[model samples]
Target: MATPDPSITTWEGIGHGGGLYEQGYIGMAHGWSTGIVSLMSNYVLGVVPTTPGLETWILRWAKGRVGTPQGAIEVHWTLGEDAMSVHLTVPAGTKVNVQVPVKKGQFVLLNGEQIEALIEEGYVNIGDVKSGVYTADVRQRGSVACKPG
Candidate 1:
């Protein structure tokens, strides 16, 4: 729950069935491309890096000063079922925080709050479940999605 501060700068989006989303790249490079497109689309277990070379894995950190670049994503599963989706175009005074993790039995749906609010907001809808595994954390302006479920 707490252990996501390795000097930051972490990105790993591997999708194409084997969903995996990890984000952490705060300030700079447009905040790591707005936190890797809101943690590869709303969070792991719903992997979506928009394909195409997948931005070559993505692990960034080239000195600070970035001020607006932040990213975090993580995804882990063991069984069947998988779903990941992502889409963000923020920039006009942006602010987004989408975090989903409700495991004990399993069941999570995002539509209005549970921590779903975007300012200058563009688009954010999440999905994950069908077997057991969940972890979706999205922070905007300085992006982030600490994947794994």
Candidate 2:
């Protein structure tokens, strides 16, 4: 009779129950669990950005083909006096059918009236008043644009 190594026995017990084998599998599982945990934690903590001078907005757009699992699309944009940044996340089954126009000082008028006209016209007029960065984020399912007041 020989004694089995504790580490090997433990590994075998865990692995016998359809456990991960390679280190890469464990790492990937950890990463996914971490992401889910973080998202849940944020929701539980009510960690939303709220400030007078800073604005945080979330828009959920559903349209064409995207690359995510929920068939939903997320687009992020930030506009300030000197810079603008944009990021887009699209799920796997949706398609984004809008063309985002980007130009300096081009404001996205989200009013129903303005949006209707712009959608019909396919474009909007932009004038040069002050020099600032403009950003446009477009994906297969949605788009988002923002500017600081």
Candidate 3:
């Protein structure tokens, strides 16, 4: 079977008593679904450069995956009874500050291993991270949520 071409197919409201409807045409797409794609890719994930470009930046790690020219960044996480597990990806050629709210004693689990970090004002700043994927288990009290990690 063959499907009719959309341009020739009569859409709904074609007979709703209108001038354009009599011609069987409609408006073009506005791309509203992804209107925030750039915003999510660049700003929400922390590619909005402190500098003019992405030589250096701050990343507020939320759970999602996005790609940039600098590199592809990804984050995944799960909540445990007493801790939170996070998976993260850093872009290449750029130094980023990743801070999250989790603490196990004085260190956090980087790739299922312990690593030293800076904890201030209920935020744990992970150590200098290389460009790669890592599974991190951090410590925190109550609901461990953060925009930095």
lDDT of 1 by residue, 35-143 (tens): 6556644354344345575663432111111134433232332222233322222223434454332322233323212334332223333432232223333333222
What is candidate 2's CA lDDT for residue 84? Answer: 34
User: Total clashing residue pairs per candidate?
Assistant: 40, 15, 8
Q: Is candidate 1 or candidate 3 better by TM-score?
A: 3
Return the top candidate by lDDT.
Answer: 3
What's the TM for model 3?
0.47
Error of 3 at 83 (Å): 1.0
lDDT of 3 by residue, 1-149 (tens): 01155553233333344333546465332344345655886755545556765677655444676789987788876665566677888888755566767544534766655556567887777757778777766655344444334
lDDT at 54 for candidate 3? Answer: 65
TM-score of every candidate relative to the true structure: 0.16, 0.24, 0.47
Better of 1 and 2 by lDDT: 2
lDDT for each candidate structure: 0.34, 0.37, 0.60
Off by over 4 Å in 2: 1-70, 104-149
